[model samples]
Target: MRYRFESELRRWEARLRDDWYFVDLPPEASAEIHEWADALPRAGFGAVKVVARVGGTSWSTSIFPSASGVYSLVVGARVRRAEGVEPGEVITAEVELV
Candidate 1:
């Protein structure tokens, strides 16, 4: 399934002294992922493999389940730069389970 949503960019400080950014998948999409994942095998940490695109850039990655009952898609430096998105900015992302 393909899930599309817009979300604000957010950042978290990692123990490695680095900043990591991600966007939480909206509840609707998150719920679907949960249902689908429940019936299939997932990667470590309950991550679902997906093909995600933002702006004109796309990559293969995994969205992980968050404590808040949603999934979070990590945005890497390369994708952020290519998409010209920053923290607090709203970005439209499309993710397809693969």
Candidate 2:
């Protein structure tokens, strides 16, 4: 189904995309994403995007739902704005990886 993201999610997604970072959620992230997307009751539904900022350096992560359980924090997006090796810069969070 064609699930349109809510304004909140859309805003975050735009930022993430602009930053050149696709969601890097966990391997099971897809499972949760699929559940939510499936709930959309449509086809071609994109994954669930959240509005979170980068917290750690080594690994960017976020929590999402899954048919198997409640929450799962998987590999999240990368910081497109970050340059060199000087740690990633956190933005005012627009969208997040699902």
Candidate 3:
């Protein structure tokens, strides 16, 4: 299944900047995350990570999902540049476990 959500990149980054970034995901989004984690195992998910661009500096979260069935979201690398979001502000992401 595909999952999509919109959040401020700066806000998200701010949360992640610390060890415990509370996302406070909604019910639908949380369900999607669980589903994606379940599906990742079958999709050959060998790695999981977050790709964020901040102030022209590209950085990614620590790799996750070295195994399957452990995804967190549906943000991927194909997302286009959106308005109001700087290159580094990670908003409306498309992450895949693999």
Candidate 4:
């Protein structure tokens, strides 16, 4: 199944050591992912594998649960370059569970 949503690319600092880029899934999409996760064998960190498309770039990654009952998709360096997206820029994303 596929889900689509729009969100801003956010930059977060992890442990005050390095910066990380991510997009938080919208509430509706997060709920759907949670439901799907309940039926699948999860990997480390209870991550759900997914293929995500942003702008003109598509890549495989996993969504991780957040304290706020949402999921966040990590945006890698390659994807950022390919998509030409930067932090705080809103972009449409299409994610397919894998």
Which should have the higher TM-score, number 1 or number 2? 1
Of the candidates shown, which would achieve the greatest TM-score relative to the real structure? 1
Model 3 lDDT per residue over 57-79, tens place: 34344223312333333223332
Count residue pairs with overlapping backbones in model 3: 11
- Candidate 2 global CA lDDT score: 0.34
Once model 3 is optimally superposed onto the true structure by TM-score, how far is the C-alpha of residue 9 displaced, in angstroms?
1.4
Candidate 3's C-alpha runs over 4 A off are: 11-26, 42-90, 96-98
Off by over 4 Å in 2: 1-19, 40-45, 56-98
TM-scores of the candidates are 0.92, 0.30, 0.31, 0.90
Please give the distance, in angstroms, between residue 53's alpha carbon in candidate 3 and its true position after superposition: 11
lDDT (Cα atoms) of all candidates against the true structure: 0.91, 0.34, 0.38, 0.84
- lDDT of predicted model 1: 0.91
What's the TM for model 2? 0.30
TM-score of 4: 0.90
Between candidates 2 and 4, name the one with more favorable TM-score. Answer: 4
Model 4 C-alpha lDDT per residue in residues 1-98, reported as the tens digit of each score: 78888889988766456668888888888887788798865668889888989888988888889888888898888989887888999988888888
Report per-prediction Cα RMSD to one decimal: 1.4, 12.0, 8.5, 1.3
Query: Residue 42, candidate 2: how far off, in angstroms?
Result: 9.1
Residue 71: error of model 4 in Å?
0.7
